[model samples]
Target: MVQNWSVFVSVSSFLLLLLLSKFILRKTRQHKSLPPSPPSYPIIGHLHLIKEPVHRVLQQLSYKYGPIFALQFGSCPILVISSPTAVEECFTKYDIIFANRPHLLFFKHINYNSTTIGSAPYGPHWRNLRGFTTLEIFSPTKLNTFLSIRQEEIRSLVKNLYSYSQQSFAKVEMKSRLSELSFNIIMRMVAGKGYFGAEVEDYEESRVFRRVIGEVFALGGASNPGDFLPPLQ
Candidate 1:
């Protein structure tokens, strides 16, 4: 019985030493290899610090920490680059590892299963899509073919603004007008029709498209809690 107790005590001591060594090693490696990070709390991590206009917050962090700093958005590790030089290096020198966009809900669900170039993972499928875009979609000839549409959209915008200000001094909001102008141009290029302002090809489709665009923009600006806490999703 005494022998068994001695053996058990010896085993427990060994495990305790092993665990302590692992803990110390982890701390040492983290300090050495990882970039500087802001204070983090258990489970939630640095998520509580994130807010609207994330770019401003990121800039502040860059100023506080460094050009390149680490962040813990819940369990996920984020590396933020604020310096142009570092950004250039990351894309040019270490691009392959960082090529794929995060497979988030917006990219996967809202963006038609991440098939789009901006959302697609970096692989042969992505290469094919990129090749198609380079060779067909954004080719100079294709853009030249859409010159009429672009000009017409611009003309319509000028006409509307003129009409709005024809009589006297009038307050005009350029933001929505410009936004709609952009949408009209893109829709004309893609669907061969303008969905906004004067002679929309399909009223029903335009209304549906307007709603979808509105929702997409709204969701894009809004923060998602599930993004930080994956289990919540």
Candidate 2:
């Protein structure tokens, strides 16, 4: 029993040391050609520097770090390219390599693992969707067909606002109303019914969907550490 225990302990220690050595070597190799970035905390990386309204924080960092910098967030490695030249290179010269967006927690949950157009990777699926959108949905012929519908919707919206403006102390939540109007118009065109006027039980569900879509946009608009700290994402 003593001999067996001694062998097990020796093997365990060897494996642990091997793992640690490999991890250090891998990190060194990966970062050898990467851009320079700010110092990060152990384990959490640059999570501490991340703040609400993330774009402002990123803009500040860009000012300090020369636009093209890297950082770690959680276990992810992130690269930020802020300069116009670097941005152009990313989208033009290294377009294919840099086209893939970082997979983040929120996108995974909200986009069904990037099945949607906005989140889908730059591949055949995205190409197909883009083709469909261009050829079928937004083609000149389609737009011409829908012009009357759009004009009627706009007229109704203007009439509603005019009526509201007639009140003694008129007030308008223009943003919310515009969002609803847009949603209704799009839903009508796509489904042959408006969420507001339809007798469907899912009218409320449609509102929920709109709200969730808005939240997703808001979250995406916010700064996220995972974007800068790529490996953490």
Candidate 3:
């Protein structure tokens, strides 16, 4: 029993020493290789520096640091490339290195763990999907076929605005009206029917669908921290 205990203790001690050595070596290598960044606070790294509308903050930081700079966000190393020249270089010279997008929490939930074309890895499947989308949905012939529908939709929107403008004490939110018109037009072309029936004017269901589409677009437009900090994602 003593011999077994002694052997177990010896093995555990060896493993502990090996892990410690590896941690120290990794730290040294990281310190030597990575580009310099702003000092980070414990646990959160440089997250405190990120203000509301993160793009603005990043743009400001780019002016102080070089166009291409590294930043730490919660133990993750983030590379920010700001200048047009630096972006061009990344695409032209270092395309392979930069092609892999950081996985984010929202992406995982929305895109089914990166199975979709937008988040899929660079491979044959992605290439195939791109080819199919281009050939089927984005072809010139497909778009041309919908021209008449688009014109009719635009005319309808104009008519609605004209009627509203003529009303007593008229006040209209152009943004909301435009959003509804755009969503209805797109839906009609893609789905083979508008949210409202052809004879129906200003249907409640159409308004609801348009509002939902607007909300979705607004959500998609904003950036999430998980996009920059992949480990947290």
| Number of the predicted model whose TM-score against the real structure is largest | 1
lDDT over C-alpha atoms for residue 62 of model 1: 87
* lDDT digits (tens) for residues 112-135 of candidate 3: 887778877777877898898888
Q: Which candidate's lDDT is highest?
A: 1
Model 2 gets an lDDT of 0.76
Steric overlap count per candidate = 0, 10, 0
For residues 63-172, write the lDDT of model 1, one tens digit per residue: 89999998877646788888899899888999998898876777767878898888889999899999998878689999898899889999999999899889998899
Q: What TM-score does structure 3 among the candidates reach?
A: 0.69
* Better candidate by lDDT, 1 or 2: 1
Give lDDT: candidate 3, residue 167: 60
Query: Compared with the true structure, what per-residue lDDT tens digits does model 2 show for residues 41-112?
Result: 655668898887788999999899887988777666788888888889888999999877767666677788
Query: Is candidate 2 or 3 superior in TM-score?
Result: 2
Model 1 residue 207 CA deviation (Å) reads 1.8
Go through the candidates in order and give the C-alpha RMSD of each one to the true structure: 7.2, 5.0, 6.2
